[model samples]
Target: MAEFLGYENFLVAADGAVRTVRPEHLRVLPGLGEHDGEPGSCDGLTLEGVVVDVAFRGVDRVVTVDADDATGTTVRLTADVRDSALTASPGDRILLRADAAHVVALAG
Candidate 1:
């Protein structure tokens, strides 16, 4: 993941320019594991959602999650079935995880 994070300390100049405070480093991960966060890194993204449906894709199943934070805010994402216990059905709780997700800044 470090390989993906090119900048060490991202900063913006008064003129609206981005810069890094340090040098660059390269790293890699073999695979993304379940439960635990990213390998050798603590960064992970988890969101709560309700399983809307699941479709079988060969040996694995693609689960569709519908997330609503009330206030009319909603988001959706797809995930692979974690285990046999997770079945394709509506109203199931979904813990959408992005073990490889990284934080990025957006102009407000």
Candidate 2:
């Protein structure tokens, strides 16, 4: 079942619960593995997946990532990134990291 842990930082279960995370909260990085000294490390959450789509939205590019959650269920996450900061293309494997403090669990 999906778990809820109030507002702010919360555990997202595999049971399908609405998450209140902003696209800006997601940080995209090249390659995989634990990002220890890297900014926005996995100390919060780390998602590895292939870039499915990239859409230009003004100065920011919306990157769509297809990844699996903790339960192994495929999930789609979008991250808003600046054009100068984006270096990913379709089929490129990337990592998405977000501080738990920016994640919120809503009752479903």
Candidate 3:
């Protein structure tokens, strides 16, 4: 069984391809905040990408996206819904923004 690592509060799903967790889970390491001269500010860093995969775990929906940046990174975002209709699907283009605390994807 795959060992679930520590939970990430923020993420973005890419391309709807399940099992590909590559670039989605990358996070800025601690002590690299804006006060320390990081390029992007600690809060409100933005990324644009194409939706790759979408998954559901209990009440939270996980999405994976292939980013269109130099890093070519993939991201995952989580959404909690009162009902299942809120779930995202494959082939969706999305924009995501996040602060130091959490990542928020703007549904397109």
Candidate 4:
């Protein structure tokens, strides 16, 4: 996961760096959603990627994301199938954002 987020800015601590990002801090945005390269101060943590695949977990949808930043790392996240206006799929460009508070760093 750190490999996939090599391009992203993360908070560092004396113990270690953040490896996993909590889902609560992450927000999945539609491709058509408006935004700049990075999430603004008001906005949450954001990541851009392509949908490598999608799976159904009962009523939820698990999305496999390949970071568009070109790190070659793929992340799997879940969301309610009935999110906002749009949903994600394979080959679709998508965005994921998380608040700094919700994103955490762990010592391994």
Q: Candidate 4: how many backbone clashes?
A: 5
Best by lDDT: 2
Rank ordering of all candidates by lDDT, starting from the highest = 2, 4, 1, 3
What C-alpha lDDT values do all the predictions have?
A: 0.45, 0.74, 0.43, 0.55
lDDT of 1 by residue, 20-90 (tens): 22211112111224435445334533445676777777776666666543233564545555366554476
TM-score of each: 0.46, 0.76, 0.42, 0.58
Higher-scoring candidate on lDDT, 1 or 3: 1
Give candidates' CA RMSD values in order. 11.6, 5.5, 12.1, 7.0
Clash pairs (backbone) in predicted model 4: 18-105, 25-98, 45-97, 45-98, 46-97
Clashes of each: 0, 0, 23, 5
- Model 3, range 1-108, lDDT digits (tens) per residue? 222553443333443322222223333221212234544534544555555776667665566555543344444433332345534457755554444333334344
What is the C-alpha lDDT profile of model 2 across 65-108, one tens digit per residue? 88877777687778888859568999999888888787767766
Regions of candidate 4 where Cα sits further than 4 Å from its true position: 1-16, 32-44, 68-84
lDDT of 4 at 1: 61
User: Candidate 3 local accuracy as lDDT?
Assistant: 0.43
Report residue 58 deviation for candidate 1 (angstroms).
1.2
The best candidate in terms of TM-score: 2
Could you tell me which residue pairs clash in candidate 2?
Answer: none
In model 1, where do residues sit more than 4 Å from their true spots?
1-42, 68-72, 101-108
For candidate 4, give the lDDT of residue 74.
47
